[model samples]
Structures are given as structure tokens and as C-alpha cells.
Target: MADLVVGVGLRDGVGAAAVVTAVRSAIAEIDASPTDVVALATLDRKAAELAVVRAAAELGVPVLGFTAAELAAASVPNPSARVAAVVGTPSVAEAAAILGSGGGELVARKRARDGVTVALARTV
Candidate 1:
């Protein structure tokens, strides 16, 4: 399986450009073959979560959502038959652990300005 870091923002903030930027950033950061990132979308839409689930299914790249509490607390159901990882701001570390537990790799933003760096560990 391949790994990708998707930056999910508010629909207002997550426009086509933002999604494109996130996907491009992820692709550039990972530097892997066979593009993994499908599309990074914002969570402003009720269907945003669904979009993520569908993309994850088709691309087989684990979809991760990063946002604040207000969005995270949304009642959107997890759509993946397979376990999916969702994280909130300041919870990047926690998301990394979840990634490990799910046999998925995490591209976590370590330094303040260094952007995200990929980290791999065995899950299950």
C-alpha cells in the first residue's frame, strides 16, 4: 500500500487550489512512485467525509482528516469498511499512533516550519 498526507480544511478554505496544493505537497514530500494521494479536500461539505472514503477505497491510500475541534466533532460517520484514521489539530502525534496501529504509514508534521515528514511503523 502507498501513503499520502491529505490536508483537509474548511470548505471555505479548502478550494480546488488548496486540494491541489495538498496533493502536490504530499506527492512532493513523499517522493514515491505511483502517485498515492487521490485528492485532498476540505471538510466544509457534508459529503467531504464521503469523498474521502470513496477516494481511499479507489486509491487504497489511507485517508486522514486534519482539522479543528468544531469540524472533528461533526456527526459525519466513518464510511470506510476498512479502518480509517481521522485526526484533529495538535493531535498529529495521536494520529501517528493510529497509523501505526492500522498498519498504515504516517506523514506527520514534526517541526513547526519543516512541514510534514513520513514515518513508518508496523501496525497489527
Candidate 2:
């Protein structure tokens, strides 16, 4: 398991470079480093997104995916009704990070770049 889990939210057709940059930036936002991250997480439907898969491969981590309803159930610091309308969950990056950590505190809030969003959570 990861000491820190990285949650990612990205649009279709996004590039791997953007995903990598977003994740790296989020990791940098907190005290943790990339090595502390063990997995990248997102909505299950997006888990196989080309950018997501490629980025995780480049980062040397696996991907953990959750269903929309599962993500909706997770409490998050930031939520958007617009996101809920589109993705069926108000929180993706933040909630996925929290859930990926198997219930932990958010270490870094959502950070977006080039249409990719990332959040970090420290495992309990």
C-alpha cells in the first residue's frame, strides 16, 4: 500500500504528460515526494483512460478505481454540483485520494493543470 495515494481527474483525450505534471505538482504541494505515492486513483469508468494508464505506467504505480456511487459516498473538502451532474459524483480527485488510502486525511487538495486534476492523501 501507498503511504500516499494520488487521485486524478481528467477529461477524455488528455495527454499523459499533463497527467504526469498534475500528479507531480500535487505530490510537491505536500511534504511527500513521488516515491511516497503508490497508486493513482479515479472513477472506475476512467481508470482505463489512455492518459491515466500511460501516466501511471510512467510513474511506476498501479491504478485503483472506484465506482461513481462509491466516490459520492466519500466526504470531501471540495465538492461541485456541476461535477456531480456530469460524473455522478461531486468529488473525484479528493474523494478518490481519500478512498484510495483506505480512509485517510487529505494531504493535498485538488490541483489542476492542462485539464488534469490531482489530489493527495496520506494513509492512516
Candidate 3:
């Protein structure tokens, strides 16, 4: 089985439950088991966010953090101009997952819930 990476995007003060929900939702959307996930990824700025940290710990994986510029360098199937205006990137979850997976294929598109967003990519 190919290893998968889950990339996260969240607003400030998000709860761990919400993060968990988003991750589960995204992975489920792609019909992948939790064991397929190797790690979680997100903006370096939010790497230390308790929600993300807690969610990664809960998922039994380390969190890989990437800078906004690094995330912006990636090309995503779905890019949001509004997200770019806010965080200087067209996408956070999709790009982070792509970059974290070594430019791998996006297995799942972005999904939002309870103030969090998640996407999945297969490791190259």
C-alpha cells in the first residue's frame, strides 16, 4: 500500500476534535484506511497549534510543517484565490499534502468542517 499524508489547514483556536473530524472526513472521502496515513502536514505557522499537534498525536504520526512560500510553490487541482489573499497561498491543505508527499498524486481534494480543512496525497 502506498503511504499517505494528510495536510491540514485551520483557523486559530480550533479544537482537536474538529481537526480529527476533518482528517477522518478527508480520508474517508478517498476510501482509505487510517493505517495508510504516514504523517500529517500543515503550515509552519500553525504547526504548533494545539489542535494540529493533538490530532497528529491522536493519529499516531508526526506533523510536517511547511512555510507559506513553500506551500505556494505547489500546484493544486483546486486553488482558492481567497485563501491566497488571506495567507499568501492558493491552498494550504492541498499544497502541503503535495509537498509533504514529495509531489505525489492528490488522493483526496480539500474538505472543510468545524473550522478546519484537510486533504490527502499519496507518497511518491
- Candidate 2, pairs of clashing residues: none
lDDT per residue as tens, model 2, 24-50: 877776656778988999999999999
RMSD of each: 9.8, 1.6, 1.0
Candidate closer to the true structure by TM-score (higher is better), 1 or 3: 3
The per-residue C-alpha lDDT of model 2 at residue 63 equals 95
Question: What are the TM-scores, per candidate, against the unseen true structure?
Answer: 0.37, 0.95, 0.95
lDDT of 1 by residue, 1-124 (tens): 3434343332322333333344444445556433544333233232255534554455455544434453333333222222134333333322332332343334433221222222222234
Model 1 error, position 114 (Å):
16
**Model 1 bad stretches (over 4 Å):** 1-7, 38-89, 92-103, 108-124
Model 3 weakest lDDT span, ten residues long: 24-33
Greater TM-score among 1 and 2 belongs to 2
Candidate 2 Cα misplacement greater than 4 A, ranges: none
> How many residue pairs clash in each candidate at the backbone level?
0, 0, 0
